[model samples]
Target: MSIERTPATPDPNWDRLVADLTAAPAEKPVGPVLQKTADVPVNRPDLLGDMPLTPEWVRTPAGWRTRAEVGKVNSVRAFRRWVRRQSTEHGHGAQVFRGMHRTFLWIQGTEGVQVATARREVQQAQGDYKTAKGHHGRRLIPGKEKYKRRAEMDKAFAGSVTAMSRYKAAQRDARTRRAARGALAAAAVAVPEGAGIYLIGGTGGVIATGSALLAFALIGRRTAGGELYHDHDVKFGDTLKLTDSMLNKIYRDAKVIGADEVVELLTPCTLTADGKAWEVTLDLPSGTPLKKALTAKTGVASALGVKVQQLHQAPGDREGRLQLRVSLHLPFTGKPDPGPLLDLNCINLWRAIPMGVNLRGQEVSTSWVERSGLFGGEPGAGKSAAANDLLLAAALDPTVALYLCDGKAGADLTPFEPIAAMHDTDGEPERLLEILEHIWTVEIPRRRALAKEHGSRKLTAAMAAKDPRVNLAVLLVDEWSSYGAAADRRVREEMERLLRLIVQQGRALGIITLCATQKPDADSVPSGIRDILSIRWAMRCLTPQASDTILGQGYAAAGHNAQDILKSQRGVGIYMDGEGAEPELTRGYYYDDDEVDLILGRAFELRAKAGTLPAGSVPLADQLRAVDDDDARVLAVLLDTFDAHLDGEGEPAEWLPGSVLVDALADAGTALSADSLGRLVVRTDDEKAKRPWLGSRVVGYPRSRVLITVRDRFGMGE
Candidate 1:
């Protein structure tokens, strides 16, 4: 039977419903109504409006309004603190004693005799030359005529023999007089036996002794030649005081400004309390550009009688102005202070890590997120030490997973092995390739998935806190030249390709790649990799070209030359963050082995607490057990393979190709593959690798090996 439809039931509500569905909602309540709605706190009152000022805010003073004020305050505090510490720790008493000792040495007539003898010899030589020149003009002919001229010159010199002899006699007499005078002075200062007790007991006698010592010290002070004694690293005296006239003279001598141009001193010359450096802000004369002064920094240093590295220049507030800082002593001469991480138990990877101090004595920090760094310098320039600072920072952060690849074969970065998720120090190209493959295929994809799941374009600390798998990852490759110098061409190419991919794509995924190499050549660190690295740290490179290679072209020309860095300035480097500004000179903090060990132990504990220890987020002991499981699996596969490939006489072959064993393991339903088996056998040569089963008879490339022993010597199995 057909169902009957109610066609007559056309309600007025149908038209109203259609109109309501099609009509736009009343224009979101214009103006104040909408503003009032938005202003209302919805579910989260903590995130709404300006906070009410509390008593704390009202009582707090309005701190420094400008950076200069803050810097000045901090500088004064640091300088005073440093002075107090140095005075106490360095022992000024010892310096005074040494100075007195040096004075005694000088007054013994030994130094005076030597000085007189040197002066006599120099004066006699000069007199003889002058006599010869006066008699027989300065010119000497060439060839046969040169020989004749020399003979004539000798005759003329000989003719002045009487005058030379007289000069020598006079010099000898003067030396004798000076020696007598020195002896008398020494005798005058000698303590009398009768007054020894009084000198030891009486304050007036003490004053007299001090006065005598001061007089001797002043007389004995030698500026040239290393005769003066310095008991401390920093000498407590003004090397050069920059007056307005001195500044003008320096500019004129350096040829940085025109002869008629005078520097307009915007600020008075201020000497640091430590007496090690002085700073001044000044405007260049009209038409004299600041670049001229910058380019002539070496000349300025020369005029100031200091090393080029001692002079630091920065742009002032306005154009054609400069802020000049002159260090009396070479920078980075003092022992480096320990870094902040030395005391901190944990750190946050999202914030900048205090890696170093700049030339201005201001803290220089580096943020790891979304940045890659290239550290290049000579072998002994402390590039490794600088890189270690960053590595230690990563270790302190529980959320950072460290992958250390030391091309120096564990000599440099072995300490990090305990906490690193993956560490390869032998610099086998294929091994590094496998690590990169794992990071690209596994770690990066895992982080990307987490980011997508959480609706984030980049991994955040919040996400890392929730999931350790999405935590920050750092890959540090030290001495990259070792890997680049791989014997296998294909392996090197593959590594470069994988490294480039990770560097370009892994940044947003919280993966940072840091490369350090002594060889700054293009072959060792290809421009392809170098250019992508946003941060560049160039230590004392051998040449400006090498500096340019590390810090990017034109950097050396722009006065950020790493080659100018003195060999003595270890750990000092030119740092560029790719911000298209002038690079900064920074000295990396010294982190010794003991400090590294302490940080590593703390890091291990922190990661344990956070459940982020890389080896499946388990404790170290569990991680070892997991490693043992793999070793056991490999042993079992080898034992089974030996039984499978037996001789006709029921004996296993003494040696077997690694490939043959790999196929047998695959057939036995084990995960061990040829690549894994090769790594096990090939890395046996590495002193750090734990391979009790793999014998020395294993041979061939990293991808293939010939195993020499498969049977147990204990006879537990056939």
Candidate 2:
């Protein structure tokens, strides 16, 4: 009864009261609050001092970045550097010696053991076969036996004999092969020793002894199951050992990837075939591109603890793939080695020219045939030295006719004057213009005609060998800007036009023009000429603009900036072979003054032997005066006869009779007859103008020199 009375007393405002308890409180009127909005400026100058403006690490002694950089430059690193220098200087020769020794030991030891083993196996097999044969013979019965028994015995005996014969033959064949190998090994050793002694005398004996000892050591180590050296032990310097973890760390530090992302290696990290660099191919994350990696080359180099120049990157086979090369050391830092042409007595222009070595420590050779090249750099940037690589190579080839125009007025190119067909070092723009015109009008046309006569569209080595007129012609213009800077504008314009024509049309005719300039600007090297040149070498420049002028427009943007080259690295340059080829770093081979002299001397001898020396070496008048008395008499009579037959213009008759010259010689009291004159003309013609005064009309007919040539020869010019 009490619970029913309490239930009946429920309030009507209970739902409203519960809703009011759950609902939000009503908004109260409040004054403006002092909230610091992001857009608002702080008002307290004292509290907002430079403390917040500067980074927190600036107030501390050192930041993480600074500390990391400092940690890398310590005594341990210095000691490592010292160790690397020592290994580079002293260990290379030792490694080479050890390698040679090992080779010899393996050849001798393995071959000897193989021969002995083969001989023993052959003897044992033969003995076993003979014993088996003897037993079979003893068991055989000759006359009386059941048919099946006799037949079975014969079949078994025959099968045994066949098997034994096969085994014996196989053993004998093995022994013969092993014996041949041993003989070859002995010959290999003997031949090198004999050649070494014959070539280097007593020094070769010491080398041979050292080689033999090394070989023994190598063989002993191999037999004892020990390796002479490991790849890691022989590493050049503190070369980075590339691994997945290391790569991931490098990528993260370089900012090439986010902290949560990892680069996927498309290929395993490995040493290059040259062993001068470590190569790896990898792919970036899904949204990343290869261009990001290439653009961040310096960052990656910093992460790898190397100079920016030591790291090179190229696009891989597909999108988002990067191929990276980390050089073990800075390339071309040491004194440059001599050129390959120094050892070669002669060279052929048809082959690629041994220009220099590239960044990969591999030799770089470029073909100049059907191509023109432009080399440019600032003064002392090895512009002339790079030109000399091609010039000296051309000089060594007797078949290449060299025409040099040295505008620098220096002796750098003077050594080649003796071998040059046309050499001008006076920096005279008029002379250069004349030379270019001659090349354009005379040389190009002559080469075209000769090529046509030989049924060839282009000049070839074979054609050059057969005909001297069809040889390759190379025109080198050092300091090409000197011509453009000439006082006369007309001369400069003509030169540029002729150069453009020569570069565009003369390549197929076996004419190559190599132009070099210290100032590689639009004014110095006109775009019309520079654009047609396929091969361009840009050495150290003052700006990327200058590099673009030499290599082509937009090349500097493509990461081939010659200005990036160190001033200390003189001959190093960016080489662009063609429009499609990527520019690469190359160090031109050094050619000092002494080396140039030697090369010139050798070239002189080669040209002299080939009879390709320039005619300017001897004066024509002097040559004419040096003729024998009989030749002089015949020449005098021929000159007189030509004078009598000359037209009013003083031109010699197109066709003159041998009899007429002979009659004149007789009148001059010469004993030479008409037949003798004909024979003399034929004989002198075969000598390729041994006597410059002598001229011929038909094959058998003798003709006289023109009036001007006669006057010039006799020094009778006005």
Predicted candidate 2 versus true structure: per-residue lDDT over 160-244, tens digit per residue: 5665565566566656766676677666567667777888987986687667555544444332234343333322234445556
RMSD to true structure for each model, in Å: 28.5, 36.9
lDDT, residue 585, candidate 2: 89
- Which pairs clash (backbone N, Cα, C closer than 3 Å) in model 1? none
Report the C-alpha lDDT of model 1 over 339-365, residue by residue, as the tens digit: 888889888887788889987676887
Model 2 residue-pair collision total = 1
Taking the candidates one at a time, how many backbone clashes does each contain? 0, 1
Worst 10 residues of 2 by lDDT: 29-38
